[model samples]
Target: MDRRAFLTAKKSKQPASVKPLPLEGRTSTGLAVYTGAWTKSEITHLLKRTMFGARIDDINYFAAKTMGEAVDELLNPVAALPNPPLKDYDGVTGAATPDNDVANGATWINSVNNDGTIQSRRRASFKKWWMGCLLQQDRSIREKMTLFWHNHFATETVDVSNANLLYKHANLLRTKALGNFKQLVRDITLDPAMLVYLNGRSNTATAPDENYARELQELFTLGKENNPNYTEADVKAAAKILTGWRVDTTVNTFPSYFTSSRHDATTKTFSSFYNNTTVTGRTGTTAGDLELDDLLNMIFAKNVEVSRFMAKKLYRFFVHYDIDAAADANVIEPLALILRTNNWDIKPALTTLFKSEHFFDVLNRGAMIKSPIDHAVALCREWEVVFPTAAAEYADTYGMWNYIMSVAANNQQSIGDPPNVAGWPAYYQVPQYYELWVNTDTLPKRNQFSDLMIGNGYTRNGKKIVIDAVAFTKKLSNPGDPNELINELFEILFQIPLSQQVKDQLKKDFLLTGQDSDYYWTNAWNIYIASPVTANYNVVNTRLRGLFKYCMNLAEYQLA
Candidate 1:
């Protein structure tokens, strides 16, 4: 359509927030497949929950496929594991431990460096690389799931001070992100960083440290709130079964090892919650693996509790925070059943939940408050903010990543280090689950981040990364018409739709220069499109920048 006819044609009213259908009403359809209209709203909801942020390209791409196909592709990742973090910190400080073995640009994950200062720098580099992964993530759910598992098995880089060990622990989480949950627990039990953080190395026959054992059931699997859960005696017995495992710090490869001398060769018995199961004592070389298998068998036997606990966590992360009795009975229970029926495989359960009618319900949409990382990364992607390419400008790219990581850390969701073993309280804490992410201090900082990006942005190594307002607006379907432009921007930037009155005020105040007629914006956009000169570009660009800035500051932008 030509610009004049497009503006003169009879246009449909702007879509309001999703409302209940006349027939189905607000009642949830539960885990059944969603057969509703697949528009931009539905696509945005799916990607917002599954990935970090929903890009326009991704939205258009997924719109052509069935919801089942999109969810399947997200669950099944084919991308290779990202290369390890490099040695990108040399000139920052002279007093830090000199990494003599690795070159300046080489990856430090393989070389074992025990120096405290150098290890600290490497940890920072790891954080930068992690931020890059989120920014450059594929269409799959690997990076998000990797972060979920990291929080599930929380560890602090400060506590586990070895950089190499931290890399290995994270690699383990990424590798088994969508794999078997039961086996992930098994692998994390023997991870060297975990052994250091939870005092697993100190757990021996003479002095049994119950730190890891208690957390294994209480936090990781069965959960502390379950009725008739494992007892204190169960914790002690589990610790005894796990006594012989120790970290071999000298070797860089496979640092965790089992020591026969440290093994407590006594029969360990559990409480009636475990059906009074007993792991028999063993001797010789394979005692540690044998007892561990027995322990996992005992814990996973109560598949109902294990599955329910994990199902709740996943629900909170990927769906809404408040899981009332209705959600529990209808959504969580069936999802847990799917998880257990699949023998603890994570893919099938997530696939069913993402494609469910309950998940795509109107009430479920825009219910979640974006976490710190979500707020930061989504702004970059949805605005098409640019960052230096890592392959071409390694230091400049990592420096930009470090700046991004620092912003998120200041807002209180550090990537490599969560606050505690229970992970971020926002995921599991009751009464105010995700609301913990936004307080007086963090909210201002959040707005400041958006303000900075849409305005000046951050600069590093002679490269300035900022959101180009004109570039973003040009990508819209109809930028010449002020109403259509607002509609397209609202469709991408917001989870919920703005009222028509508010959108009109926004257009008049910013786009139309406080005038009543639409031709003001239409003529200005046309002039810029025709001439392609600096003064003409400034006219449209200035208005677009103001419009975006005002929209981002709204409370609605913070919701997913």
Candidate 2:
């Protein structure tokens, strides 16, 4: 559409009707009260929760809007775009070549090489595009959903040197991330990277590898704890069913000319858990493709397994990890109902969760720690920062981000590659996962990041990255009273109302600084950016520095 027509069309769209807030008497005692229609705190909370985090500019833009309006914009973002496809490699067909020796640590490169040019370029491009997507992608839902699926169908490059195939698999996940859970599962099973990683390539008639098949049941389809319906026999049978699927290492294709010569045409049987009729067709000889489809059909026909499996995982991811009996009946069961009814349509399940009253409950807010990816992405979104242009510069920024991921990984929360195929141990209800996230090692790192960002202590090289605090102050139309400004900042940062003690501390700290409230606030932030003692040369000694130290040391800084 032309710009003029687009503007006219947008203007023509009617505003959604606003719902009145429930009365204090009708609402729960713990529910927060809003003094005005909308405030900066609410906007900040929405941004932080919906995106990664919010910047001062982000808070200012939506501060005056109602919660409903702000959330609507987030859930249905305008900027998010579809993931683009990777450029295909030339002269490299799907055939098993010697794995890159450097990648395998079999040979070391003293310097960059002229040979292996295509492979090197592909790897670089893949990293650049992957980071770009996280930093610059317009589609928020797609990006977020891609991250979710990346974890769901977790595969690493440790085993696969074919960068093109890896990129293809990653793109596939992004493209179908939010589309259909069933289709995604089917595609991943056949994905070349997955095929290689899970021994799908080695799954043959003589001896079928049970790795992928076992995970398909125990980890992917059913909850390891509650649903143990399938047995060892079932896994072996499923493995046999999957044999003859192999990657064409040359072109990165799959189900390569299933050698009927090498095929295990033997019929396989499973317990009552699986429909016996589905596998009966494979008696003497069956096409590999038909057998695979029958297996998927059989799995899908047992809707109970998929629904229960998906609903539980979704609950742990979006909601709290703990699932009560009542929640199972009310939230989880309903989610499963929608999933099955919609034929495993993911968006519907997500929409149901987002629209539910339970989603907006006070207890659920600030419940999750900002995962490393969450923290990095939130910072970029809030500040509207772009990735650095230079590769070395990009690497430095990525190093900082990766350092955080490493800390989380040490705490058992890596984003790209989790601990195992089962994914970050935390997703499961492991006590150690929670305990690991806040040990002595990780707490200091988390505090350091908070001090650097919120406290304003970040730097590049020897120089401090200055925040434009004066510009921020001038942007506020109504400067209002000190109390109002503090309230606004609190709302934006915390989302929930601040306790009286915390509020009083902020006021007292503001008074002690003695500069104009705005300037002091700004400089206090500058102090935060300089708190890392090893990076201390980037910041000078100042009162704001001292205050930055004080605020970051507080317990509240630990929350999302």
Candidate 3:
């Protein structure tokens, strides 16, 4: 059934089932440091934006720290980068070559294989591995920032068509998730997957491909909306400067090399927007690298435009989508200044914005519809949904991750493959913005996904991975008290606070089983606690499952 029909039926029973964001735009709270209370509400808000989901343990762990300390810990990730994608599949049938070179569970990232079927399987492996990273992310903002950078510097694995190149590109994003933005742009310019995706490899002295150059200015930096922005001539000049770069597959490292012969040696000039700056082209090996640096310098010199554009994108990703005049003046403008003042080091700016009063403001919470990946990851992480271990259950582990990737792809936020070079429309599209995530088709699928995860979950290789609702409630302060259990669950699972009336109704409908007294649930839970025998266990487990499933299916759960 469609989302409209489903939500309508749901709302008929529970009036608070479908709460949409207010038509009025977002909070006017600026980048001033917030001195407000740092309760579960604020902690949940911070974690939801920074991490996949705010697990109970994560919220409580961060609760010990002051706001600055928590933000500091989040920005500074200490974990080692995850190991590369492995060869998870058996031989691909009806193929030109076999993938038997790499062992069943060994990493295929460094191995060189040009076989189409093998590359295809490796691509699947790459996506599954990426999902695993998101699932197993540490208590830091690294994963979320990595994803933000991925969307910002989008390169499609499908278009690149090389699994090794895709893995390298992904590694670049992860390695520099919070590194210098200007350096990242430079790195991405020479990245092999980017060269393949944006036709940078084909850009030569005789013929220039304006694809990457145009995107470099329009989408990446000096955003298209800015008045007197980089001209078409500037794009052509940048493309000329970027010529001669080609992926060097002959070398073991598979890096992109500068081909001196293919480079344009003529001087390239920019428009008035860049103060008529000219990048003097040079000859020999250093020409491509030097000219490219000059081009970036010229663009980044427009620091206001570049920083503000970046701030807006970051704001949309971490905060609300809409950027009103007040938000632009109070938040985006100053945030841009912070970015520029920090010399494009992303961590400080992120640190400030995340700790600001505006971030903690009530209106800022529950302002965005969670992206498909966000929703899926949050569901698994928050619920502590179990997956098979990669060490022993290699196939099953990857199989489960692959299932999640497929579900996300179907929901329109495919990790390795966004719809286009512009990335997902939901991030940058106007009027609708994040609202694009929910629609007739995708919303029901979202609900169905949570329902499945909360219920039977997805079974892989004879192992069923689902939420252990009984065990999860056992972690609560008082599972015996129906009201406290509901309150605790709401605090963890929801961004917006539910009314006491709604909580009372939920208790009656699910835990209390329509009984007037709360002991109906309290006694059932205590009985199960005393004797976890099949009969008593079934009584509590059934109620808890129903409670969680119904809660997850609510419209509030859809918001991050």
Candidate 4:
């Protein structure tokens, strides 16, 4: 039967014609293939890849829907952005003069208003708040895409020291997360936080800085070697065009503005790289806007390089990090075609990819090593972890932000403060792209954090009851059945394949207490469900915790 009809009739008797996609070494061709009956395994794979973690109820819902419905639910986000509601710090109302020694007034202003201790506190709070957003995911892809864009156009809050502006920059990213890429680049260019961070505020016609301009081309758009594409001359011209932008973090409204006089009004010429193009100079209030549009038009018009660069980045993000020859031929090329055909609207292309057969290839499943965020957030969701409030987490001891930030930060993926401008080395670095996420330094920290949560539960601010494995099991569809509990937990927690002996060994050790019969586990769990007392709870809870922690601590749990 077809996938849709089978989903509607019954899932238990579902028959599927799913063959693993022709992939090896974690890469496959990009062609679409017909789908068959969807199983729980398929649902498990879908949710883990798309959402942070899968809830059993959510999995059942998607399993009932058709392919279009499932893809649309994810593609079209319908949730509101988190309301951090940060104060807009005013630095311009009564500013310090350039007292001869104060030539760089922006840096001076930041130093005066932003105390080091306060700045560090605000950054920590922001990281925790963002972690909650990642954990809850009230809206799905926005947070995911915000992170994607953060890494894509990385800027550290330490460099952009104004918390309000950092908050403002984050809002811009989250709002425009799934919107137009061309527009996102335009907005990012003028964002006050970015302006101050990348020294775009200091960029001028007299002394143009190529920091933002070079990254705009190299990191955001054209990658390295696109023929007839870009050059050093192009970067210089772009810098001149982007000059005269300023940030007034002092004001609540209109923090970022253009200084018309500071803008370069000289005609900028391009090499044969861009058909020997020339952008006409203007001397008015609209000069910056006009030049920006002209520049974006020049870049976006070369759809091939721009499209491929974005497709490759997104694929590496959601799928495997390393792209093999088969992936290049099948995946990247065709995905880029979809982007070009859609006027750079991201939804259609992403929808096409996520719902395609290539996405569900058996070889492709769990091929990616989990980033710190993936590892921390997924486990917390499974364990039903709860932490203190972050609406305005105090910077004192045992703050929720403190715990969350330190957890991810210690694991080598600091939330708000990525290592540098080029983002965490894992995303951009070669050969050992994802391998960089784990090292001697990070693995022990990861293990320690996992042990803390699984063993003691995150009890802070008078909050406890972290991972009640006994209660977790009782809520399952077939908790009294030992084999059922083992399979179900494995399905929920582990991503990689396991052998029958491995499954039997788990059953023998954790649930059955070395007995060959499943009755030991069944009687223990059934007694707990019936009595609901401390002794019964402990009897089942202890075994469940041991098993749950063991599964999570396994290497397979390190993948999505």
Note the Cα lDDT for every prediction shown: 0.86, 0.57, 0.86, 0.73
- Specify the poorest-scoring 10-residue window by lDDT in model 3: 5-14
What 10-residue stretch in candidate 2 is worst by lDDT? 1-10
Error of 3 at 103 (Å): 0.8
What is the C-alpha lDDT profile of model 2 across 1-560, one tens digit per residue? 01121121111111233222233321121112222334454355445555556666656566656655555555555654534323323323442442343332111212122235445545544544565566565524566667777777777654555565667777788778777888888888888778888888888888889999998877776656645477788889899888877776444342234545455677878877774544643533456668878777777777877787888887666655656555565567777888999998887777666545445544555555566566545544443443344533544444344443444455445544556687765567464433345567767766666556544535546434322333333344432344555555455445445577766566556523544355544444444444535343232234334444454455444445
Query: Cα lDDT for residue 83, model 2?
Result: 45
Question: For candidate 3, what's the RMSD?
Answer: 6.0
- Residues 1-560, candidate 4: write the lDDT tens digits: 01222222221211234322355534333546426457666777777777777666676688788866876887678876775623212323333431232221112222224445555545655666677677777525677788888998888978887766777788899898878888899999999888988899999989999999888888888887676568899999999999888987555443789898899999999778677888988878999999989988888877888999998899888877777777766678788988888888787778877877667766566667778887777667666665544434322223543565667787988877788877888887887888788878877777777877768866665665266676567657798888888787777776566667998998999888788999998999888889989999888888887788777778777777
Q: Candidate 4 has which clashing residue pairs, if any?
A: 29-330, 30-330, 90-250, 91-250
> Which runs of model 3 end up more than 4 angstroms from their true locations?
1-25
lDDT of 2 at 313: 83
- Candidate 4 segments exceeding 4 Å error: 1-28, 85-117, 227-229, 388-398
Report each candidate's C-alpha RMSD, comma-separated, in the order given.
6.1, 10.0, 6.0, 6.9
- TM-score list, all predictions: 0.94, 0.74, 0.95, 0.88
- Pairs with steric clashes in candidate 1: none
Model 1, CA-based lDDT: 0.86
- Candidate 3 has a TM-score of 0.95
